[model samples]
Target: MNDQPAADTARRLTTQEAARALGVKPATVYAYVSRGRLTNRRDPVGRGSTFDAGEVEALALRSRREAAAPAGELSVRTSLTLIEDDRYWFRGVDAVELASRYPYEEVAEWLWTGGPRPGARFTAPPEALAAARRAVAALPEHSGPVDRLRVAVAAAAVTDPLRFDLSEEAVLGSARSLVPTLAGALLELGAPAGDGAPVARELWSRLTAADPEPRALEVLDLALGLLTDHDLAASTLAVRVAASARAHPYAAVSAGLGALEGPLHGAAGRLAHRMLVEVLERGGAAPVVAEYLRAGRAVPGLGHRLYRGEDPRAGALFGRLADLPQAAPALAAARDVTAVMARHGLHANVDLALAVLTVSCGMRAEAGETVFAVARTAGWIAHALEEYQERPLRMRPSGQYQGPRPPQPLP
Candidate 1:
C-alpha cells in the first residue's frame, strides 16, 4: 500500500475544473455556491476556490438525474386535459373558451362523458345530503370548511350502497351525487336550505352571507369550470392511487381531500387571500411583499411552475372581475402585487384571482380554499374514473433501496 495521508489522496478541483465536470460555466459554479447547492473552499496554494472532486461529481450526477426523467416517475395516459403553451384544453377544446361559455355542470359532464350535456345540473340526493349535513354538524364548531367537507364525504360514503360498484356508469352516478353532497353539506349552520340552484349559487350561500350579484355569480360559475381539473395534480394523484387499489369513489375522494390539506397545494389560496387583505389594510403591496420577502416566505399567488408566462386561469378571471365595480380595489391590489413581483419574473396566478373574488365578495380568507376543494372534487372524480379503468395496482412503484445491506448484524 502507498504510504500517503487520506487527506492527500482526496482529489480537489479548481473552479474551472469543477465547472467542466458539472458541464457549466465557472460563473454558474459560483452561482451554485451562492445558492447553497454546492460548496467551495479556498485553494491551499492560493489558486482561488476549490471544490471536492467527489462532491462535484455527485452534483453532476444529481443534475443529470433532475434533467432527465426522475427515478420512479410514472407516465400516466390521460385524455381529459392537456396543458401546453401556457394554456390548457379540455377534450380538445380551449378550456378558457369552454369555461366562459358553459356552466360548470356542463363542463364537468363533458369532462366525464366526452360530450356536452348542455344545461346540466347536479342535485344531491336527499338522503345523501342529509347524511353529509349530519356528519358536518358533528365536527367541532371551529372546524374549517375543508374539514367539514372531508367529514361530509365520509358520511355520504356510508349512505351509498352502490359505492363499491366500479363500473363507469355507477362511478359517474356517485360523482354526480358526491359533488353536490360536498357543497350542500357546507351550508352555514343557520343558513336556509338551498332552493335547487346551480352548484355555484348554493356554494355562494355557504361562503358568504352577502346576496349573490348576477355578474359575481357568473364569475363564481366560471371559476368552478376553470378549476374542474388540471392534469395529474397532487390531489388527483392521491385519488388515482386510492382508486388503483380498488377503493370506492368515496374513499378515493377522501384521499384527495387529505392531500389538499397541504399548504403548498389546496391551501395556497388562503395564503393569497390573507396577503391581499394585508395589502388592503396597509394601503399598498410594497410593504406586505417586503415583509414576505424578509420572512423568506414565497409571496403566494405570484407564480406557477407549469406556466412560464401569465397563468391562463388568472388571466380569464381577472378579465371578468374588471367588470365589477365592487371588485376594483381587490383587483388593483392583485395587480400591484403582480407589478411588484414582475421584477423577479413572477406573474399572478389563479390563487390571486380567486383571492380577489373572495376578498371583494366579503368572504373569509379560507373561502378560496373552500372553493378550490368543491371545484376540484369534480377533478378527483374524473381521475378516479380513469384509474378504475386501468389495471388494478398499476401505480405501485418499487422503492429504491438505499439502506445498509441486509447481511449486516441485526441491531
Candidate 2:
C-alpha cells in the first residue's frame, strides 16, 4: 500500500490563481490564512506560498453561503431600496438611470415617498443653517467631517423646539433641510460656501480647492444619488435601530454617522481614496499593489460581497468618467490598477469609483466619507420614517449562551 498522499490532495494553488478561483485578491488569500479560514503550504520549489486547492474551494463556497444566509435579526422589511443582480433599485427605479437625470433633492424625495416630483425644492432655513454652523464650529478643528456632521445633527436637534414632532410631513420637511443644512454648516466651517445652488454643488465647494467643472458637478450629483440608499448597510441598520426607539430624525442620522466612521462601512471610501492617491502619487499601479500584497493588507476598493462581477454603480460612474478629459490621467491610473487587480479576479466596487471621482475632482482625502454620510442621510431619514410607523423597539434580539455558563460548579 502506498503511504504517500495522492497527488490531487497535494495540489496547491498559487496566490494569484487561488485569488482568481476565490474571486478575491491575493491579499485576501493571505488574510484567510492569517485568520485560519484557509491553510497555505510553502512551496519548496516556488518562491511564494500556495494554498490547498480543496481548501480554497471550500472557502469560496462558504463565502457564497454566507452571502445568502438568512438575515435573522438583521432583516427588516424595507421598500426603500434593493441591491440585486449587481444593480441598485430605488423604489423600483434603476438608480443609474435615475441618477443621470435627477439631482439629489429629487432622488431623495423619491426614496422617501413612492413618487418622483420633478421640481421639488431643497432649502435650509437661515436660522437652522446659522445654528448648525455654530455647532460645527464648536468641534475641534482636527475633527473629521463625519464627526462634525454628527455634532451638527445633535446640535440641530437641541435647537429645534419641535424636534419631538415625528409626523410624516414634519419628518419629510426636516429631512429635506437636514442634508443641505449639514452641507452648508460644514462648508462654513472651512471653505467658503457656494452661492445657493444644488446641495451637490455646495458640497463640492466645501470639499475641494479647485473650481468646479460642470461635468464634475454632474458626476458628484450622480454619485450622491447612487449612494443615497443601499438596503440594510451597517450604517443604515444603525440608523434604523435608533429610529426604532422613536429618536428624532436628527438623532437617527447621528447614529448612522457614528456607524459610518467604521473602516468596513462608509469609511471604506476614504481608505480606497488613500490607496488610489498612493498609486497616482507613486506614478504607477504595480508598485502600490505589490506593496500592499507584501504587507498582507487587503487591497481597498476591490471586490464586494454583494456584487458577483462589476459593481453596477462603479461601472456606471466609470463610464461617465471615461468621457471627461480632465479625468483622463486619473482614470488611466485607475484602469491600470483595475487591470492588475483583474489578474487576481478582484474588481472595483462603488468605493473605488467614488475614490476615483474624489481624486479626479481634487476633493480632500476624507471627502469620500463626506459624500457617503450626506447622501446616506436621505436614506436614514426614509428608514426612520418607516420605523416610526412600526411597533417601537422591535430590534431586540436574544443572545445565545456560548460562554462557560457562568462558571457552573463541576458535577
Candidate 3:
C-alpha cells in the first residue's frame, strides 16, 4: 500500500498560484524547480506548469524555516565589527572612512589588532608559497580561483609545524603569510608579482594581465579594504565554527573558503559581472533585466538585505569609479542596471560595484570572487582569533528535531 498523505489527492496549483503561496515572484518559483527545491509538471490543459499543492506548501514551509532563526538562536559577542543605522563599523570606527583613508594592509592590520600599523606589509614565506603553488598547480584545469585557494591553504598548512598553535601571535603570523600565499598560488594573468607590495597590488597581478593604471590600482586597494569584514557573514561564521573546534588557523581559513563556494555568497559578484557584460553587449539594461526576470532568476548584485537604501560599499566604490575615465562605460552600465532595478525597490550592492571594477579592468568574471576571497581572509583570521578565546565547541547549536518521533513499525 502507498504511504502517501491524503493531501496528494488535493488539487494542484498553477505556477502563478504556487509563487503567490510562497510569496515569491513567478520566476523564483521556476528557479526553485531548476534548483531541485521543487518539482513541476507541464499542464495538459494549459501552457503553464502545475505544482502539487501539497509539495508547494511543504517547500514553502521549508523555505520559511530556513529563512527564520531557530528557537534559542545562537549569538556571539564580537569586538571586530558592527552593523547599524545603515552603516558598518570596525571596532567602533567608521569602516568606510577607515577603508577610504588607509591601504588594504593597514586596514587589515587594524582589524587584526587595534593598531593601524601604518605602512604594514605582508610577505608570504618562500617555503609556504612554494608548497601552496605546488598544490594549486595540481588541481584540475577547470578549477576556479577559490578552488585553487582551498587547496593552497591546506598545502600551506602542511608546511607549518606550528600550525596547531592557537595563540594570538601565532595565528596572526599564519594569517599574514596565508593571504599572500593564496594570492601567489593562483595562475598569474600577466602582471608580475611585486616584492613586498600591498596585498591589493599582489592580487592585481593574479586577476588580470592588463597594465595597472594608478587610479585603477587605488580603487582596487580601496575595494580590498572595504571588503575586509562585515560582522558575522556566512563565511566568517564558518571560520568561527572551525576555530571553535580548535582547528588550526589555516584549517579555519580553509573552512571559510569552503563556505565561499556557494553561489549566494562568494559567487554573487561573478553573476553580476556577467550581467553587466551582457548589458554592455546589448547596449541597454532593459532587455537584460527583463531576460533575468523572464528566466525566473533574480537580478544579482541588487538589493542587499542588510541595507534598506544603497549599500555603502557600492556607493564608495562608485564614487571612486567615477574618477576613472576608462571605467566610464562599465560604470554607466552599472548605473543603468540599478535604475532598472530601482523600479522594483532594489538598489545596487557591493557585488554590482565589484562587477564594474572587474569588467573595466579587463579581468575575467571570476576576478571579483578572487578579490573577495583574498580580502576576506584577513577578516576570517580576525574572527578566528576571537573564537579561539571562547570556550571550546561553543558554536554548536542544538537541533530542533521535527522528524518522526518514535518507531511505530519497521519499514
lDDT of 2 at 84: 89
Q: Write the per-residue lDDT of candidate 3 for residues 217-321, one digit (tens) a residue.
A: 999999999999989889999999999899999999999999999877899999999999999999999999999999999998999888999999999999999
lDDT winner: 3
In model 3, the clashing pairs are: none
Q: Any idea what lDDT model 2 has?
A: 0.82
Candidates by lDDT, descending order = 3, 1, 2
The alpha-carbon root-mean-square deviation between model 2 and the true structure, to one decimal in Å, is: 18.9
Superposed model 3: Cα runs more than 4 Å off: 1-72, 407-411
lDDT of 1 by residue, 1-411 (tens): 245456844687889899889887786687567546688877656769878789899988875654454447777767789999999999789999999999999889988878879778888999999999988888888998779999999999998999999877899999998888898898572245455779888888888888788899899999999999989999999999999899999999999899998877988889999999999999999999999999999999989999999999999999999998999999999999999888999998999999999999999889999888998898888888777655467677667889997799866
Q: Write the per-residue lDDT of candidate 2 for residues 171-237, one digit (tens) a residue.
A: 9988887888888888532346455678888888788877777888888888898888988888889
Candidate 3 deviation (Cα RMSD) = 19.4
1 or 3, greater by lDDT: 3
User: What residue runs in model 2 are displaced by over 4 Å at the alpha carbon?
Assistant: 1-74, 188-195, 403-411
Better of 1 and 2 by TM-score: 1
Candidate 1 structure lDDT: 0.87
How close is every model to the real structure, measured as TM-score?
0.82, 0.79, 0.82
- Candidate 2 Cα deviation (angstroms), residue 54: 52
Q: Total clashes, candidate 3?
A: 0
